[model samples]
Target chain A: MNERQKSKLVVETCLLAGKIMIENGSEMVRVTDTIDRISHNAGATEARAYVTLTGIIMSATPDMGSQVTAIDKRTFDLEKVSTVNDYSRQFAAKKISLGEFYRCLKRMDKDVKPFPFWLQMIGAFMVSATLEIVFRSNYTDFWAAGFVGMIGWCIYCLTDHYTDIRFLNEFIAAICIGFMSILLIRAGIAKSADDLIIGGLMPLVPGVPITNAVRDTLSGNLVSGPSRGIEAIMSACALGFGVAMAIKILG
Target chain B: MVNVIIFSVCVYFATIGFGLLINLPRKALNMAGIVSLIGWLVFHTVNVHMGGYLSADILGTFTVGILSIFASRYKKMPVIIFNIPALVPLVPGGQAYQVMKCLAIGNYALAKSNLIQVIFIAGGIASGFLFAEFLNQLYLRFKTYIITKKATR
Candidate 1:
């Protein structure tokens, strides 16, 4: 490719890298770092990336126009983040040519595969049951929490698949967890409704976002920090509201 | 004690479960679980002996943060992959749930206290992670300085 075309390709590659990292729930600082590293490794004289929770704006050299990519959806996929890190490290070390690196990134992005549904359900079950014992120090509600948590996570995934509304899936999942926990208590299968509900809600809480918000803020990304913090708070509020609604309606 | 062992086992498995939920790479899952187990053990011991949740949380997350940093370096992965999963057990999900329950029952007083507690715990976790990062940065700088000094000699 010509020099101009090469610069443009570099910008596009950086933008694609940033988009994947941000969309896969990488911290804002790491996103910018990865973008800058990719552009720099591609021989850009002056490359800069400004990343926030919602978008990424990157420019490489004055001749090549800057590129902007908006990030609309985010989900936890640390595996993708690690893969991008590995690819960038390889590119920086000259182990992979820029063309090959770009091609690998494109293929990886297109062929994203998360854990299967059944395995994820089992994870949810184990998280709820084991956390119940850890927090409440009781095994009476172990199976109850597991079943409720599995069903709640199932509802969450289903709602996410069917609905496009933000935070609605978490709300619906929390409501299901509440109702299930209460039902189990009524059926004399669970000893404590509080323990069961808390355990089941473990899978739904916004732990990653909250931690990322703190880490971003601490690392001096003022823009993305509070934005991610607000996202965490809003989801927490959605969960709390759903649980409250369930209790008000049934209790 | 038997209780400590049980809690430790639960935390290890629970951390792995959370790791799977977030799609952590398979090779790092066991290490993340061990990090979480150590952190929770520290938190449990501190809380039981001292009767302070905030301090226990701060110390627990500090240990988790430091260990995850090392684990990431050893595994050649991003620190976040290990940090997020290991931090799950220390997150105050139960207290947050109780805060909502209090509000639902019209118990404003209890809700207010629980809200403050949640904020404090969140802050503690944040500071703990920050301190760990700070120390890591310090260590890196020190290592670089020693290398340069050796070169000059």
Candidate 2:
């Protein structure tokens, strides 16, 4: 390829790497740092990257000219993020060529696998059951939490597939969890639904987002910080509202 | 005590399952579990001594932050993989639930207190991480400065 073409390729590749990282839930500062590093090592004299929870914008000024690329796809997959980090570090160390790096990134994008549905359901049950133990609940609560939590997760998976609206999906998941908790209680499966419902909702809570929001604020990314903070609160509220709806309607 | 150990063990396994649900790598799942177990242990231990929820939250997260940095370096992986899942156990899940439960029941007073408590806990955890990161940055700068000074001499 010609020098100009290669520079353009580098910009595109860096943008792709940044996209993968951001979509896979990397921190905002880390996203910018990785993008700049990749572009700089790929022969860009000047590189700038701006990332938020929703999307990423990057520009690279190589000797040929300047190029900008933006992508708006966000998901949470840490395996992909880790792979991108490794690839960037290797590329910066001159251990990998641009073409090789590009190929690696494409493979990383496609290669990361989520746990199977059954496994995730089991995991959901385990999470809630153990949370009951931590909450000092009785054995009956533990069993009921497990059963209800798995049902809640099944509901979550179903809704998550049917809709791309995250808040709505979470709201529905909480409602399902609350409904199951109440059923368990009525069936004499458990004494109270409070701990069971809380435990069941544990998996859906936005723990990582809130933690990242605080970290972002402390690191001075004002826009991303408050935006993520609001996102966390909204998700929490959605889950709460769903549970409340279930209680109000069922009782 | 046995109670603390039991709580930590429960947290450890729960975190492992959480790691699985989040699709963390196998090695990372193990490390995240350990990191969270340690965080829970620290929180309980420090709470026993200090008798305050906020201080325990801070100390617990502070320990997790340091361990995550070390784990990231050792495992040749990003710190986020370890930190996020590990922070799960300590993430004020209980308080958040209480806020929602109270709000659902129309107990605005109880909901307000729960919301404030969640804010404080989240703040404490964040500050702990920030402090650890600050210290880590300082160490890196000091090491580089020493090396450069020696070279100049």
Error of 1 at A4 (Å): 0.8
Model 2 chain B worst lDDT run, 10 consecutive residues: B1-10
Instruction: Output the worst ten-in-a-row residue range by lDDT, candidate 2 chain A.
Output: A62-71
Enumerate residue pairs that collide in model 1: none
- Taking all chains together, each candidate's TM-score versus the true structure is 0.98, 0.95
Provide the clash count, candidate 1: 0
> How do the residues B1-153 of candidate 1 rate in per-residue lDDT, one tens digit apiece?
988888889899888888878889888999999999999999999989988999999999999999999999999998898889888899888888889999998999999999999999999999899899999999999999999999999
* Model 2 pairs in collision: none
TM-score of 2: 0.95
The model with the greatest lDDT is: 1
User: lDDT for every model?
Assistant: 0.89, 0.81
Stretches of candidate 1 off by over 4 Å are A110-112
Chain A TM-score of model 2 versus the true structure?
0.92
What's the lDDT for candidate 1?
0.89
The backbone clash count of each candidate, in order, is 0, 0
